[model samples]
Target chain A: MTAHPLHVPPGPVDLDAIATDATPGYGGSKSDGKAALEGLGPELADLQERLFAEGRATGSRRRVLLVLQGMDTSGKGGTLRHTVGLVDPQGVRISSFKAPTADELAHDFLWRIRRAVPAPGYLGVFDRSHYEDVLIARVNELAAPEEIERRYDAINEFERELVEDGTVVLKCLLHISKDEQRERLLARLDNPEKYWKYEPGDIDARARWDDYRAAYELALERTNTAHAPWHVVPSDRKWFRNLAVGTLLLDALRGLDLGWPAADFDVDAERARLLASEAST
Target chain B: MTAHPLHVPPGPVDLDAIATDATPGYGGSKSDGKAALEGLGPELADLQERLFAEGRATGSRRRVLLVLQGMDTSGKGGTLRHTVGLVDPQGVRISSFKAPTADELAHDFLWRIRRAVPAPGYLGVFDRSHYEDVLIARVNELAAPEEIERRYDAINEFERELVEDGTVVLKCLLHISKDEQRERLLARLDNPEKYWKYEPGDIDARARWDDYRAAYELALERTNTAHAPWHVVPSDRKWFRNLAVGTLLLDALRGLDLGWPAADFDVDAERARLLASEAST
Candidate 1:
């Protein structure tokens, strides 16, 4: 089969443009994020029920890959919680990849990740993803320069392949200001309940904020394709960030228009027979 | 807090008794498993909605760990898929633990599992869990005899603590006869799509069926506390297995009587502010 050239968008879409067009500015609108969610809750509920029901009936297990990449304290976890909250659990699966195992690094970086992708008719949310090749690997100077460049190309091709074959790829970079991150880190240290989530490595990383930002910008420039465009959400206001990110995912999934596909009656007939066998003495 | 003693059911309420009473030739009703789940689909849907909504409002996550430990080809995965189908994706999370990570082995076995438990007011399902300590470890002789004994005591304490703190632990051992397992394994070999799920190791274990059964029986005996009883499900019939396991979880979670612990709403004042905000916009 011939591989299709990826349809990456021209130049990264401006974060400012996304903020203005997609989401109402934080604290500027009559309905805040919480209120908006409260208002949308019931409708979203019905939508989820219908989507999952249709998905199962048609057996159209369309795979969705939600790749979340962000700066420190950019609310990746929060967005994951909210966005996943809006979908059907049965039709979704999440895989959070941490530092690689020895076996993982021994092979291609994509080896472990490819195994984790959602099967058809499901959503797979990645807490941090293959972008680490560009982000952390670059930031730490871990990859030889040439290998790093190759990964960017492979990722573009990989995403294109998945999208072409019915996987929906939605990538997000939750962008928070350096100042806001410092404040959040301090708060995490202060709050005992959140203490377990913090590590000393986080403080070391915070010290290199500018380097990380540059890496992220380069990653975005190279990888933002039409099939999987990156949404640089201004997460200075988490409430606004949640609303914007939630809207993006809710829209993309709805865009799929995955009404139930036709199923042969044989399985249904067999299922009835199976159930009947149980009922009969 | 003083750790409580393990709470076993008095006399005949344990899995052994249940198994004996449930055996078809032992004069128990044939369809007890199927009958238990008669109205479960709707009930589970309703439970999932309430569970997710509670997670949102309270931000206190709870977990539903569905520990499915059974004999080879005892329909564990099928039961999991069928049951999760009835749950809302938002409030539920499922983790399938395979081989241990290096980090997992470095700590107590339960350490990795504890991290995966749902935050608060959420449901977490484990297809196979730390019980593998007794099952696979015993089967493979992976641990020293002393360590194996220590783990059972540790698991009992671990489960008791989770129950005390509000995690609803529902454990199911899908019990299928030796003859039935051979049938399912043959079916897996017969189907192309199911080939990936079949491992050759399964057949070797099938060869040692009695050893595995002894291991499972010991596991159920040591850890079946009132808070987390072991439900020895008759899984010879895959459909009935799914229904029984799903209904068991539904019954346990529904028994919790979970509702939105009253939100502190300043009703009149908030209504006025809401109206005024709408007017100003």
Candidate 2:
């Protein structure tokens, strides 16, 4: 069995070279990948508690921010359900950024983004993040070229600040082919039950494929900083996408090297209190 | 294979008669009960979407409110994971009411409860609900007997309004024996990994077991109105508790008999637009 590489480090990333169907970091079949995912559940739960406890402790500023940016059928929701679903909800904050509201549009783009950052001792997940401003904004000419360029620099500075202040920023671009998106959209149309999830405007989004791809390439190249690097995940195969993203997340948490805080109080006295209280009752 | 009777209708209640060890509604082993729970997932997802779509459609106000009240270690979290975990997060609302803050204490107790009701087309679960006002308040003498009795009447009236407005309120008391609580508390103590979940104050709560049980019985009897009936779920066997509660919830949903709302737009025109759009591109 060959070792699968999960992370694409901060450097020049060739989007075309990464196949959407390739399964890296997975040794066996779907069942095996599932078993592996199940195995990670308890570890994530335990690690999450320590992160939570550390945050709850005096002046500990440790947390994680996972940004998942992808095309419409690239399986961000599936990844969240399969991976982050394993941990206790108490320690995980999910921020699904939708379109800007009237008040939200009144503020800067990062204003809502800043408001949604996870507190210390949390594993925060951003479903569609501020990256949309660069991706969709550039593709559709929502912002001027000069403004978009300025936004990229602003994003880099914001991420650097987050990293310096104790947050681990992991950004993943769920890479899928245009053909895959077409099939997924068609399936939603065929199933009436899935009508709530479909939108005719998605067809328009598909028409801007090349533009979006070029915008993504520029965004990936421009903002892949050392402090907050970008990972390109092949997301056509749902199971493999779940596996790779889960692997990346587990590795990142493991890298934190968090330890249980030592009990500052006398353990013997607490045990004695329990014993004494039991006898009195 | 004996059938289990899980739901207790609106009537006088007895805490002692319900056997915590029994696993009714489940005729098979743990693996089989698990398989049954798994089967409910897709149906729940489908029903939830219809409910969500119905809510989104127009003015249809159909929803589910599952109030889970249990003593310590009766598996409210476990039930949430196994059962409600199956549905989409988009169509579910979870309100885990903890001890009230100073602002909350200043207002009437039901003020906070009113704030967390589920919107139309969502299945809402309250982890520790408004019943705490009656349970802990009565047991710990936080409120006078007259005030506690008044709260019972207030609760019934509040629930009546919810029922009239298209909410099916299913209140479940996860009834576990004192012995089961002791075992679970000790298990938490024995495992270092689970220390974060363990509270030292739990032992003090156990000391007032009979008082709590009597409180639950009186609360159940007083508030068991026709609009919102209390279901005493025997929860010692974790698998059975999930199955019984899951069954009750699924039944309640099926009872609503919801259907997918018809597409308001012209279907042929939309399909033709997609086909034409594809050819033009």
Which candidate wins on DockQ?
2
Q: Write the per-residue lDDT of candidate 1 for residues B82-107, one digit (tens) a residue.
A: 67755555456777677797878999
How much of the real interface does each model capture, measured as fnat?
0.06, 0.06
Q: By summed lDDT, which 10 consecutive residues of candidate 2 chain A come out lowest?
A: A272-281
Q: What is the TM-score of chain B alone in each candidate?
A: 0.84, 0.93
lDDT per residue for candidate 1 within A160-225, as digits (tens), equals: 888887788988787776657666766655554344345556655766666786787678888887
- Which pairs clash in model 2? B4-B24, B4-B25
Report the poorest 10 consecutive residues by lDDT, candidate 2 chain B.
B272-281
- What overall lDDT goes with each candidate model? 0.65, 0.80
* A177-213: candidate 2 lDDT, tens digit per residue: 8778767776767777766666667778877877788
- Tens digits of per-residue lDDT for model 2, B1-281: 32244666556667888889887656698788778878877887778767878886647888999999998899998888778877766456677788898999999999999988988887888999999999999888988889999999999999999999999999999989877776776675566545555566676777787789889988998888888988888998898888878887887888889888766655566566555554311
**Global CA lDDT of candidate 2, please?**
0.80
After superposition, the stretches of candidate 2 with alpha carbons farther than 4 Å from their true spots are A1-18, A24-63, A86-93, A103-122, A137-167, A221-223, A258-281, B1-13, B24-42, B45-61, B87-93, B102-121, B137-166, B264-268, B275-281
- How many clashing residue pairs appear in each of the predictions shown? 14, 2
